[model samples]
Target: MNTWQQAALAAEIENQAQVPVLSLAASASVRPSRRLGRPTLIQMGSNIYEQVRCISAIVRSYHWRGVIAIYEDDAYGGNAEMLTLFSEALQRVGSEIEYHLSLPPISSLSDPRESVYQELLKLLSTQSRVFIVLQSSLPMATHLFQEARRMDFMGKDSAWIITDSISSFLDSMDTSVIPYMEGALGIKSYYSKSNRPFLEFSAQFQKNFKSENPEENNTQPGIHALRADDSIAVIARALERLASDDTNTPKMMLKNILARNFSGLSGNIIFEGGDLSNSNSLLFRIINVVRTGYKELDFWTQDLDNPFRREGRDKNSSRNTTKVLDGPVIWPGYLIKRVPKGWEMPTDAKPLKIGIPAKTSFDKFVKVDEAEAEADKRYSGFCIDIFREVLKILEQNYSLPYEFHPVIGTYDELVDFVYNKVITPISSL
Candidate 1:
């Protein structure tokens, strides 16, 4: 059949598929934890006008004038719209904007050290004013900060403004400077839905899958447990429309979703101007390092009346632009800081043996030789690859002499190993 006919048949087949609906979804089976988790999820995005306002406020407040935004030189980074808004805003109060440069994403940089650093030095020499970084990757931010610190680029003259791309722990403490990255500010997002529309979504989600949950446990799955919820949410709406309408049109469903508002567990998502790619976004602010972490100062939401960030206004002067929180806009820096109290690497660079759960959803997904199920690959499979990345990062960045050596151990074997050796000293430490 033709392409349209093929899509039509697939849509029909999806409806006929025996997959359980979200309303009658089955409970997720739990497996034993084989290794300790050092989890930090980082999602990246582009700069919107709201981000511009919030970050600009913090930067200009520090008495520094002018800006030099070194972004990833791609459609995602060197956005002309965002650059114009930021540059214009910076110039509003007579602040001099020295430069706005877009570098390649770290993923594409074949020669990150020489090429990235050389271009950075060029910006440093030519456009050394106020630094505004817009890298979409955390590793790239770390590299830049590390290089800048090694080059002794911190002082009264050189100021920086970054985003949530860098950790707050690194921001305030200035482990590179060992004292602080004082005066440097940025924007970060860290609000649970429960804090706002959180309870509403939780209540509905619990209702939707309440029957599937084991009655005895009497508890909803954790936030982590809801990781699969996104994929389900996207597919669920499609299935529901297909089931209810019997038309099973993707374009129509897409139209319906865009016409209305969607309040997800993350936040309210709205599609505007037919850009299904989710272009316009909310903005947040990082005030200053409070203690050993970066704190969120404010937010500039798309909604004018949102009290989350600051008082924003529409032409009508109807909604309250600023959201007034329970307390002053303050974010505890440790919120995003690395917490490795008992997990710190020692001087000897000991390879802290980690017992892998020999056959986990994570591990089973990585056995390349075996023919894998689509669901297994789609859901549980990325764990091993993720674990490898973590190990690689630890080996590359931390005090470890060698890589984080991974050893295979079963559930019972891991339990015994932890009980006899690993658990004892760590508990005391």
Candidate 2:
């Protein structure tokens, strides 16, 4: 970990620490002492069917059939359930999957001497051009890029695509690879879908909690500590109903999670079987790296056509559009772009160094406490899982390119890179 500071959203959330926090870490030292009685739910909001359709269309349109290097065997396996659905759609257009190689995890590939890169070398040996990177972590994904660079893989017309899972990794990625990975593209789940529903939720959230803060300059509105706030919304609503039903037991909570169909602020809340699906995810376009923060790219994903604007959010208003709500809003600490052109670094101050968070913040809905006996309450996040489906859907139905990768660099390293001109600034564009 490195020295760190909070973004506008982080500050917003810190102002309201009384609210329940979302947990997403996979470590023994980080689990909470108190156990949550609620069972974890797999998030399913994105549209995967549409994504698969989009990629199939792109493959057919290009008339190119090359090898596709997939990542692990989890929900994102090379030939998993989603691929089966995608293959059916692809078969219609005379295009088929050439190869399905699952890249090893980041932990396994940390050792250059490790055999993980060997499989990639074999896959690339077949001279595959149009590769689909499906690993969620960019560090692992970068391993393939490193192999390609080692093999001199980039050229004037080479094209690669990734899923939304690795898009966030680009935010704090190493800029040295920008020239090598510039043409790399990504499929996004939610870009600026932080519109009215999201804003509306934030407003109501603040109104309910009296300790809200004013909006800041060069920032957007959000509460901290909440993952996407979509999960919180779903849980909040479910709790509302459960309170009415007067059922607060673990089995009852699990039953509620399994039996109910929820409408969250993010979208229609759903699980594996319901009409809701991460498979229904959207697609956004990523071009260049915004410094070290999040990748600021053009929003190509399908968003609500009717976006609501904050009534008193005008620049003239003392409190234009920004407010701290239930928790911390996850703002891009390191954007792809640098500081504004007219602004200069503080005088007599050395270039700011990036630092790791003092306390690790959990952005997952998955539970991490191992001592808790409730197996249903153990693993807490499906947001990423849903994101996986969403991007998959984009590839399946929308013909948009969805790539994947691993998160390699240390959190501190990313912060330093961001402040030191490693990436670019974030943009709504």
Candidate 3:
């Protein structure tokens, strides 16, 4: 199926018609039926469980209580379901989504980049700076991020976490879009490239694939391709175990497949509960994008406690398991230190009112020129000048709004007013 939702719906329809189906697609296992002999799913895509664990670990490490979620619209079939899984993962770690936004499919929108910018602006209007993006393809991710950079949303205070569906194909992404993706953190499927079996399969597959499709030149086989080959092997092996004369029913074939085990190009091919067995082979790698491309910052497996260890180091030592990265990450704005706090005050908060002493003995230092005949009034003093300078400095970091309010009382009265009230009081003695 072309879309995740369509694939799932097709499976359900085939099941109702009593036709057994074995699905080899990315989003088929997004929400699988637990009932036996319904549809056997051979996942050739990213698993939602591992994604949940990896992203939750990063969010917890940063101590972010809330974030905004942006995803492709459900017209793509499985986007909504993926978002549900994301929300559940955040809730499990005592964190939550502050807001969730949906972007229309690229084909449906006249200008997808403009759509992304509008949605991104809505995200910026909120207090949350941390964003979790769920997309099905690399190009769509590039489109969204390019717009984010244009809006100045990709800054030192911003944090972006992307799922495997988008990140797995980073090596093949267009170079023009790579600059906009710098400082982004992504989760991707992992396999040991150094393994002899994997290397042998990769070489042969690349050679054979090029020979068969000469016109489709300069192509490289990705994880999905390897999984496709393995999926066929699994079905073929299951067919071999079936009796030559026995009926090839869907249920019978599923039983035979589940009972068998084999090794494939990427890793061991096994299934549990209609999905791939998530053991050592169901691994994930977290990467940070830089000017050059991306670098592996952390590795995670089902059995590892210390997921973030220095590269080339095999075992854990004394580092805290909860710390997400092995070393410092280069954030947006080329910052190499200081983790972002993930949220800021919205632009709608009330302005600060600074109470100033109007009736003061020192007119040069503090003076409030009040128009007795009219409602207009003005204030000027050395203290007022200093306050304005400090506010200017704060403008660089914060969107603070403040104004000096002339107090019609003595310094002691102003002090008493500030003591009883919440407004900040200033004086020039």
Best by TM-score: 3
Residue-level lDDT of model 3, residues 1-429, one tens digit each, is 545455556666777554435554455344364542446444445566567667877887788888888877758456656667778878877788888888877778788777777777777556678888865456567888888888877777788888776776665455556778888888877776777877787788768877876665334556666677777787788788776737767777777777667767656767777666665633777788887778888776654344444547655442344565865787766767788778764344545556777788888887787765442236677877777789789889888765557777677878777545545444432
The TM-score of predicted model 1 comes to: 0.47
Q: Give the alpha carbon lDDT tens digit for every residue of 1-429 in model 1.
A: 211122223434544442221111111111101111101100112224455555555544444455678765443322565567777666754565576666666778776656667767765444244677754355556666556655655433455666544432242222334223444556554334445446665676667555665342233333322323543555566556667885566455644444444555434444333221223344343455433444455544454333244334342332232222212322212222221121123345344543334345554554432254562343234555786668687877665433221224456765776544453323123
Residue-by-residue lDDT tens digits, candidate 2, 20-104: 2223211111111121111232323233444454445444544544436465433223236456655665676566665677655
- Cα RMSD of predicted structure 3: 8.5
My TM-score estimates for the predictions, one after another, are: 0.47, 0.47, 0.73
lDDT of 2 at 330: 20
Model 1 is weakest, by summed lDDT over 10 consecutive residues, at: 27-36
lDDT of 3: 0.69
Model 3 bad stretches (over 4 Å): 16-31, 35-37, 40-42, 76-81, 205-220, 242-245, 303-321, 344-429
Off by over 4 Å in 2: 1-41, 45-50, 73-79, 109-117, 171-180, 191-228, 254-265, 268-429
Cα TM-score of candidate 3: 0.73
Clashes of each: 12, 79, 1
